[model samples]
Target: MRIERSNWEQRTLGEFFDLQMGKTPSRKDLSLWEDGDTPWVSISDMKESRYISDTKEHLPYQTIAECRIPIIPVGTVIMSFKLTIGKTCIVSKPLTTNEAIMAFYPKKGIEVNSSFLAYALSALKWKGNRAVKGVTINKKTISEKNFSLPPIGLQDNIAAELDAIQEVIDGYKDQIADLDALAQSIFLETFGDPISNPKGWKTELISKFGRIVTGNTPSRAISDYYNSQDIEWIKTDNIVKDLLTPTTAYEYLSFEGAKKGRIVKSGSILICCIAGSLQSIGRCCLTDRSLAFNQQINAIECDVNHIPLFVYCLIKASQQLLIDTASTGMKHILSKSDLSSICLPVPPLELQQQFANKIASIEQQKDLLRQQLADAEMLMAERMQYYFS
Candidate 1:
């Protein structure tokens, strides 16, 4: 990660580029959005990607002129500076963004490279006011932040090197995603679709195989409850996609807090019954260790008759049903009653074990890939700090 720092010059971002804060169009004007064609960028669209080619929302061409939104040209570097501070990307086409994002393009007579600028911005240590969701930086504060600027040729070289590392990271991610698909494929091949019960397996309510317990949050006002990290406290955010176990948690509980909350032992299945969106209603993962969780999750401790892993897969395969049920409710949530009554295919114990064995083999390979991904990400962090911090 060593670099020639003697030749690099420190420059404020505002000094090298013309920066413009983006603005949202008036939402009430139906006429302005009638013929949507122009891309509108947002923080969510920049999730873990180096380039933004398209956006989740679009505006009609006329809306841009009518709303007085600045048209950001292709190759312009954009960074989110408000809630999700410092997520940077190079725009692949003409687009406009909401107020939280700021666009930076080289000023006239400057030879700045968009990819290099984007990489620098992404790696920059953003200083701002922190909130529950993310950091917030005003346009003036962000514009004044300084970064090391190497010669134009060095910039190109650095960007190319980083791009190579990024390709490796993306490759590992693709392999992990493929393994997940393979796991789902193995489940379907072994037992058909759980929702359709195509194999004509016996179907029973989820509660028949286990006792269901809904988690609860320990009172926040009681300082003694959180005085020590004696136990792991699980939350919906900890239940990552495709991962059987939860990731490291930011919040922990003391012995006192653990008593206030329900603890589900290892091998029990945890599902997100309450969430902000229908898509998250049925997301489930198996616990690798005993842990206390919040009300957003429901835990099912399977008995000898059913395998927890098998049940996890079955519930996962029937996710659409959970989504539909959540949609029917007044809010995007599934109650304990709702979860307990949901029926799933009941394959024979031997068959369930066979499916679990196949998934275990697939998981072993995924673990190796995940370790490689972690190593690549660590290298990326170190290199970014060396070049930009």
Candidate 2:
């Protein structure tokens, strides 16, 4: 039954739309996959889009036919239901998702507008059964939640206002991507592409420049090992490619715990060596301060021959190669020896310093853009509250 509000018709979301769960193809069957046009999507693919069309992985049309994986049509609203929750987007183009996502398709004769629903669904918080590890939402949980829907004309108007706000957010994000591209360009101009060696730069094995050390966690049985002071514990989750994001979730430690893992000075380069998901393997983060990391991570320190930022770029450049070499048996693991085996072109110290100088300037501009992006995000948040509340 739809409840009549003063200016809106209230209906449970399940009453308004038919839910379609996503499916993943069996990994054992290699024949099911081939390079083709269909977007094989996961939650990570929707990271930057309001309407999802493209994905990191593409599936052949045959895979869709044989696997019986439902390819969601354009304009269906999709929300992540596991690991990450409440991440919603409308399918602007045809795509398929993994099991973690669910698509909400307008039911027969239901005139619920897609534009307004996409934005509203984002603000719809699932209040039941969110475990410490992750959040899960099911049909029963979704059915109990009330959704207020405006008339079609009013929905269009609100969507227009929200779209205007989204444009500003998108603009700021574009600038951030451009700035990252500029840094890559500068590195290429100075050292040439690492793979091509177009400028004929000398190459050296990574082992020549730095020492790699894997960290360890003190025995969890000893509760006192974790509660001490003056140390920051770094986990794989703390590692991020973006320098702006702060990694915090400090597990403090005393001498007994610190001795178990590698400790490096500030400005050390960190790589995620072990991860449950392959997407995170080979991801790198630079520590602004000294920290201790667990067994899932490996750190490199080159206080003598290499500039920290330059070393960061070089390590970042080799990420794909590192991912390729990572052992994918049970957990994705990039071993210390595997990292040592890789090589990079050693540009002159002065050239590397010049590249670092360019990064310093680019970083300042990025900080300003990040501020603008933050403001745009706030405006979007305010609009969501204004309309949904």
Query: lDDT per prediction?
Result: 0.86, 0.81
Model 2 agreement with the true structure over 1-389: per-residue lDDT tens digits:
22234788778878888887877888787766667688988888878578888988878888888778899999888988777778888898898888878888877877767878888888887765767777677767776689888888888988998889898889988898899888888888878778677898788887777778888888888878787886888888788676532288457776678684478777778888898888788788777787788888888887577887888887777678788889997799988888888777888888889888899899889989989989989988887877776
lDDT assessment of candidate 1 = 0.86
lDDT value, candidate 2, whole model:
0.81
RMSD of each: 2.6, 4.3
Residue 176, candidate 2: Cα error in Å is: 1.2
CA-RMSD of model 2? 4.3
Q: Write the per-residue lDDT of candidate 1 for residues 14-104, one digit (tens) a residue.
A: 8877789887877787676676878888889987778888888888878888788998988889998888788998888898899989998
The number of clashing residue pairs in model 2 is 0
Worst 10 residues of 2 by lDDT: 241-250
Number of the predicted model whose lDDT against the real structure is largest? 1
